[model samples]
Target: MGLFTAIRDVLSGFKSLLIGMRITGREAAKPILTVQYPRETLKMPARFRGHIQLILDPETGKPRCTACTLCEKACPSECIDLDGLRREGDKKKSVSKYMLDFTKCSLCGSCVEVCPSDAIEFSKQYNVVSLGREQFAQMDLYAKVEAEAQAWAAAHPTPPAPPTPATPQPAVTPAASIAPKAS
Candidate 1:
């Protein structure tokens, strides 16, 4: 309320803080409960979910994404953005713009959970640093995959088979046509 009261409040706050410090100091002197970080990686619990990643199919050189956005909707932070592309023949559904902004991502793992095609996942890569915003925003999750597919297609183009000769068939005519019209 007054200048004296304000000074008294500040002193009380300092006393409370010192009391907390004393309690922590006592705990520190006792057997350490905190695990050593980095050198000794803490065991993450099964419930401790992590970030989302896209895995490519080795044989097909394509992601398992079937254009299903279950993960996108499932994410509370709305970090996963999937751009669905058309299949070569079908021209209906596939993923064109597969993007996951880990910056905005809260590492909730909702994307991994809801992925039906098993394309999106939690990668083992724990620490990835980026300088520019563009570098961090890695949209081309399947760049390596696309390149592989291109190489395969080029290597194994369909061979053109030689044309086969058709068998000759005898032409047939009616008896009346053979006798000619009786005009």
Candidate 2:
């Protein structure tokens, strides 16, 4: 009975080894899914959310944020801090400084949804890395976007200036009429 039991234990161990080898073989035969990062980057899916960035208005070349504070209120993590100033001639307050503390962000999309002007959107930047936490603690979204806009403006040629219309001169009255009428 001891001999038979020992043989059975050996058979069980062999079976387990075979199963492991089979799985390994199958996996080894499959295509390599490893992306050689730095040399090759994987395209992020459309819905991939990395961080919040202010959207620039194409027409104005400025952030669409009106400094309404709706996004700040909607953020559950309370990572957003911003200020706005209404210029003397401006109708709405323009965002003066927009800061994002990414350390506490939950990526809940609450801020993006609550924004009435669609001023904010999730950034596609997925490779964010840093040596210290402080680098990401206070990201100035307003200044970053502003710098990008300036760089783009420098790269692209400005549109041609609209032609100024010629001013019309008043017609001269007849000399006879200009003189006092004989009475």
lDDT of 1 by residue, 44-142 (tens): 565555556566665555666777778879989876777687777854477777667666788877677778778876655555656777765654565
Task: Please list the residue runs of candidate 2 whose C-alpha ends up more than 4 Å from where it truly belongs after superposition.
Answer: 1-5, 156-183
TM-scores vs. true structure, each candidate? 0.51, 0.80
Instruction: Return the TM-score for candidate 2, rounded to 2 decimals.
Output: 0.80
| Candidate 1 wrongly placed segments (more than 4 Å) | 1-51, 90-92, 137-139, 144-183
Overall local distance difference test of candidate 1:
0.71
lDDT of 2 at 49: 100
Q: List lDDT for all candidates, in order.
A: 0.71, 0.92
Q: Across residues 144-182, which tens digit of lDDT does each residue of candidate 2 receive?
A: 988977876777768999999889899988888788867
